[model samples]
Target: MVHLVKSATVPEYASITGVSLGLKDKVVLGPFEVQFIDVDMYWSRLSFHVNGPDGPKLYVVGQGESFVYPAADNQYLNITLTWIRSDTKTALIEIQSPLQKLLSGQKLNVGDTINLPEGFPQISIKLTSTSDTQATFLVTLPYGETQTLVITEGSGGSVRYKLGDVYSYSNYVYIHLLNTTSDGPATVDIYVPKVASTDFKIVREGEEETAPTTTVETVLVYNDLLYVNEKLPITVDNVTYYVKLVSTIPDVAKVEVFKDDKSLGSIILRVNDDEPKNVPNAPIKLSVQSVEPEYKRAIIRVYGPAGAHVIPILRPANLLVKIDASPKEMLLGDELVVVINVENLGRGDAYDVSVAAPIPNDFELISMTKTWSLKTFPAFTNMPALIYVLKPTKVGEFEIGKAVVTFYDDTSIETNEEKTIYSPVLTGIKVYGIPKIEVNGMAYNGTWGNYVTATLATQSASSSPLKLPMGTRTMNSSRMPRSSSACPAASMAQLRLMLEP
Candidate 1:
């Protein structure tokens, strides 16, 4: 026997027909509820409120347009507005879901056919004949079995096959007869089972085989918060695989897949419940649940093949702040330059980092940027130097305050709390005073010789100057005259006058 090879496509389990709704009227199809709202006649547009497992949303579609939305169990729904009756204020829509639901209140006449949605395990049912009290159905299933069932009113029938002397029930399809007429019409309810992610198997030569030996069982399931550039390691089949969030933009998340240390490739996912797609030739499936662009983060789920396990790793960013002041010792009223540098020493990246340099009271801020901020700092990276100038206003030793640094990492992004660290305090900064002095002098030429005249004064830092008694004297090259005066502080200023011949 020859084997048929077909690629797996998203399956549609059930389809609903004859759904009519008025303004604010709704119909439930599996996990989806579609309500009719007002319509725009000018634009030929109709509004609908769709509520499903994902969430409630408003959709506007024109007549004959179809929209797809996520449903329960990672399934999708295709909804189309078939017709709009403006006069009756009602609209007819068709909804299809990948999961099974109750198909009730359906009227079928003899020779009527009910075809299953386009997907795996294709099936169909037909009403062959109907009596006054019984109805007959011809059911076809994916296992290549065609069975006939005759059931009375308010009764149900199931398809089954014999295996090793025991009848095995095939729950692929179920039909319930609500009422029947001899003339050839019947009202019935149909049911189909939902196919779970791991429920189906690949059949070859009439033998049920598993999807890859490694995929026979769920090896790993990872669901958590991930920051941009953060790596999540999952081990499957003893081989470690990595999923790194490359970016979080709007509703899309860019992710890079890696095996061990080698990068496989990148893929972008829009947050939704669509089926998880495996990487090419890799036993890894990734599903992005949500994206938070404000925090540059995303919530992702990863499914690994057999023997899959996750090794929890915490990535905390270590930030170190260093403050340097040149010439720790300076004179009073002198300018000082202070530089602040920040470095990331941990395994994670830091975001929205702020560094504040507090100026002491004794020092005046001449001109400087007292605070600095960094947008993104990668691991083992150093930020540019933050410099500021300050002037000492007093003559004393003081301790410089520590620089305050606050930032957030991949873990703290969820709490919105920043981790704060401070730089080491700078001590032994000394400021000394310099003595001030004032001097004045004048010179004039006389008839006999060159005459030099000057006045000297002795002054204290906080007190007035004390002058000694003035004594007029003239001196020649043979002799020199000297005079001295002292201040209250015992500091003295002396003057000597001499004439050159």
Candidate 2:
């Protein structure tokens, strides 16, 4: 009955499901929640410190978390830990695709890479390839693994991805890749968020470009074929160029030549280019033998490609060799219009038949419209007569006097050869000035005393009389005077008598 007299003492221990070894501030995980457990707070004699490879262990005590590493000592027993299964399974895949040219008509080869974003510890790319007409590939990216797709063109060349898999936000995904086959020149179009449209262009080696020209002032002059006593002063750009002359004009040129305030000499200027540089300035001379009589036109000849000149025939006066007429002349600085009607009614095809104006001898040929051809017209049509514009200095009406037509064969036919200048049917303008007369408040024609002499009613249009009792004649739209009407309209009657001085 004395058993209670001797009592046994119980030892203090932690009854944890798994043994726990931790530092002072570290919490040890266990199978059950800890309520009150005895822990050896200070047992320095049995403990020794162990330093980690990293500085000062992971013993951090921040705002909400703390970490304390246990000290390694010979007396400390190892505590095994048990892990709990919170997540059963998870999958992640990584995929990458390169750029492609849809129209290249060649094989596509590329290496791709993709970097993972922050929140996704890993992701499955689930890549696919397609073409405008067909699909090229399909693959599910495995977890945490990179899937390499050949991206080769399939039955129908195209590379595409699963629509549902790609999440489109404000920004779209665009892939760009390198191209090795295109001579280092390539461009890829990408659909992305807020980027400027860009186009790339390439420049090849040899290209091209251009350059401009020059002109010189030149002058030509002449007098009749007659000899001159003095050299005419001719200037090229205001600079007197001593040249030999050729002229066929007669009795008009007052030639005087002076060099350095001294008389060089004077002579008839005929022709100049290609003449010898000797003989103290031979005052330009021209020879008729050098000219082809057939051109009826002047001949321009060149010895070099350096651009030459064609000297025109000159007539000093409008009237040259008039049979019974006086010499016709015009003053310097005056202008005149001389019309030469050229009618080419030839039956044969003359390829280059043209009109050549023979300005009276010694006259200066100023300007002209270009020469045209009769060949350009329809068969059997007449050419418009040539009109020569002129100004003269010598007052005389003589005739060198024949309008010539030049043929492409270097031959010419003068007006005399064709007998076309003498017009049998002649016409002149007649004006009338009738005294002011009115018919009862209706003005009959107040502008009278206006020389009133009418054109004789033609015996027939083909023939007209020079004199007739005057009356105003009105022509209808056809140009023949209108048929006699009951009412006489002198207003429409346009007949005026021209006074001869």
Candidate 1 residue 409 Cα shift, in angstroms, is: 1.7
Q: How many residue pairs clash in each candidate?
A: 0, 77
Model 2: residues with Cα > 4 Å off, grouped in runs:
1-333, 372-377, 408-501
lDDT of each: 0.66, 0.27
In angstroms, the error of model 2 at 329 is: 8.5
Model 1 weakest lDDT span, ten residues long: 1-10
Candidate 2 shows a clash count of 77
lDDT of 1 by residue, 1-501 (tens): 111112122224444454667776765433456777678866378898877778987889987998767544454667889987878777877765454545777898886777665443335677878889888887654333356778778776654321112123243455778889997579987766443121221122234443422123232256557888888888777788889999988889999989989999998887654456576656878777679887787877676653578876567898999998988987766788999889998767898998889799998888876448876787778998999999987777789889999999988987898899999997888876665554433232223243333444444343222223545444342232222122122122234332111
lDDT of 1: 0.66
Q: TM-scores of the models, in the given order?
A: 0.34, 0.17
Per-residue C-alpha lDDT of model 2 across residues 186-240, encoded as one tens digit per residue: 2222222211111111111232211101111111123112222213333333334
C-alpha lDDT of candidate 2 relative to the true structure: 0.27
